[model samples]
Target chain A: MILQYLKLLKDKRIVLASSSPRRKEILEKLGWNLMIIPSEFEENLQWESFSHPGDYVVATARGKANEVTKRLEKCGEKPYLVIASDTCVSLETQVFGKPKDRHDAQRMLSLLSGKTHDVISGVSAMLSYDDGWHEIVFYEKTKVHFGRLAPEEISSYIDTGEPMDKAGGYGIQALGGTLIEGIEGDYYNVMGFPLHKFCSTMAPYFGRLVK
Target chain B: MILQYLKLLKDKRIVLASSSPRRKEILEKLGWNLMIIPSEFEENLQWESFSHPGDYVVATARGKANEVTKRLEKCGEKPYLVIASDTCVSLETQVFGKPKDRHDAQRMLSLLSGKTHDVISGVSAMLSYDDGWHEIVFYEKTKVHFGRLAPEEISSYIDTGEPMDKAGGYGIQALGGTLIEGIEGDYYNVMGFPLHKFCSTMAPYFGRLVK
Candidate 1:
């Protein structure tokens, strides 16, 4: 199905501006051999400043894309497109990034033990043009329902070290899967990238670029 | 989190009565060294005989489990438990198994495109008791909403040869992820196993067996 679209963009140089293995793996499903350049952007955005969690992640994703775009320009390497994304977990109004430490992970998991939370991922696609870059920003949200966790379960999960680098102190694709009762959206979004939305958004962009 | 439960079942023999790599991968997430013994049972159940799609799959799973359990007993090996599962795609009252060929896959995808269909997986766990075997059977349902797939896209997806071996003519965890708009239950259920439900069902049984 996507083979034709993949063939169209085969000659183009695509760059992913992040070091997340999950995100890279998600994008590679489109059959693009991506060039990875982890962005040096400082992701210290204030979550409270934005009214919506999606806006906060979009701002952070934009920061990563912009930083990587500038770096590529500095090196005189103009890639056809640059992709970046930021994922976060939110419980109502409060947003969570990666856990700072073990205690932080435990606190997040404890709070989310028997609740349903939203996993939001913001993506930025920076397309280079004749003069400058045209950036498209979007976000996808998935609701993840956690099974009631015992204190020992939380402690034991934290000990495995999977929660340290994931939002909401859990990775849905790993041992953390046992903790999730169900989900209500794109499963890939919870893994840090929204594969369906990303593919839909890029189809037209790639169509225009190829022409 | 599951390490303790896994430790309890360490010395016991566990069998998965299916040849599906996807199902095996889903179960291995619980840290079990499963023994594979694909059942010789013929899947010739009449979907019309069952009241619901879940019942139809549960019956099929029961057959597989019973056959594998008998085989193990004949070999003089009383395994701790035998896990078997059957998955199918249902739209309304109609059930779909694996497509017979590319055309059949295309037909299934066309009917499912832009519509929400149910992916139901029935699991049967046969536990050896002193006198005989106690059977535990349950089914999990997940609603999968697929994007409107173009004819070309459907043909291309079938070309990948992923749909022939999978129920619903698609594999949600692979190239088929692009075709899905969203899902509304345990993602693992769509992959032919329900991890959360399976874990919950086995916890109490494991407790009794270990004691």
Candidate 2:
């Protein structure tokens, strides 16, 4: 869907406001030349302050995008567009991010075993025009069904250390894939980026999103 | 779910009887040491003979696995287990495989645009034992919803040369991600190997299948 705009975006100054390999790899599909400027926004937003997990994630992503855009603008750097993303695991009203340690990962995994949870990803597209930057935020929620995990299984997976940096204590795109029974939505959302949603959301700005 | 058997499968002579990079990448998550041997079995079976696309794909995978197993056995190679897989696109009763040419790919993509199609993958696990070879076959279906595509867009994607070797004229794991709206079921299934289903299905034979 977004590949149609590759030529138009080829020369644009695309700034990816995140250093995540998953987000980078996912966005690379558009063939957009990108410059990574890790967002310096403090990700300490209070979870209880939001009415919904989706809103919190979107706000977080927007913060990242806005910080990157402002930093570039301060340096008089021309960035046609800045993209940011944030992902979290949610069950009902509870939200979880990366685990602090192996025990925490195990606890998160055990709590998720043999149950369905939502993997939510919020994305922000900050486009710079002649006047200023215009922003749009979107969220994708994927229902992930985890298989019953043995405590020993969770312990060993944590030993591998793949869960330490991933939200929900697992990376669906890797070893953690075995722990899942299946998913009911965009798998990329579970990978920390929402590919389809990003493309469709940016589709409307085809002519203007790019320089 | 399957990580428990990684140590057991560590020493087994596991061979993947296919050359699809996507399958190899997806299967690598299990940390299984693998050997790639492209099956020489001709995929010329008449599709019309099968009652369902799933059956045809499974039969095709079986053919590949059997041929590879026979070849390895003749060489006195101890291939403890061999895995082979085949995938196709099914829309209701109509089924589509890799496009024969650019025009064919364009045709397939056009038909799939703005419509939901099923990505069906059939896998065969041929286990070699002292007495005989035991074969197990399985299939997974993923519903892929595609966004509407213009003819120009299809032509451009085809021009990128990403659709030729993939089923349904798209590789969901790559440039084709933009074309998909979302997917329901195991995402790996659309990539040509069903990881979760493979692990869960082989769970019962854990002890024997691994070592």
Q: Could you list the chain B TM-scores for each candidate? A: 0.96, 0.96
Best by lDDT: 1
lDDT of 1 by residue, A60-125 (tens): 999999999999999999999999999999997789999999999989999898899999999999
How do the residues B1-211 of candidate 2 rate in per-residue lDDT, one tens digit apiece? 5687788888888999999989999988888889999999999987789998999999999999999998998998868789999999998677899999999999899999999999999999987768989889999998998889989889989999999999999998988988887888888999999999998888777756544
* Quality class of the docking in candidate 1, CAPRI style: medium
Two-chain complex of model 1, DockQ on C-alpha atoms against the true structure: 0.66
lDDT of 1 at B156: 78
- Model 2 interface DockQ: 0.79
Residue pairs with clashing backbones, model 2: A1-B178
Q: Each candidate: how many clashes? A: 2, 1
* Model 2 stretches astray by more than 4 angstroms: A209-211, B209-211
User: Model 1, which residues run further than 4 Å from truth?
Assistant: A1-3, B1-3
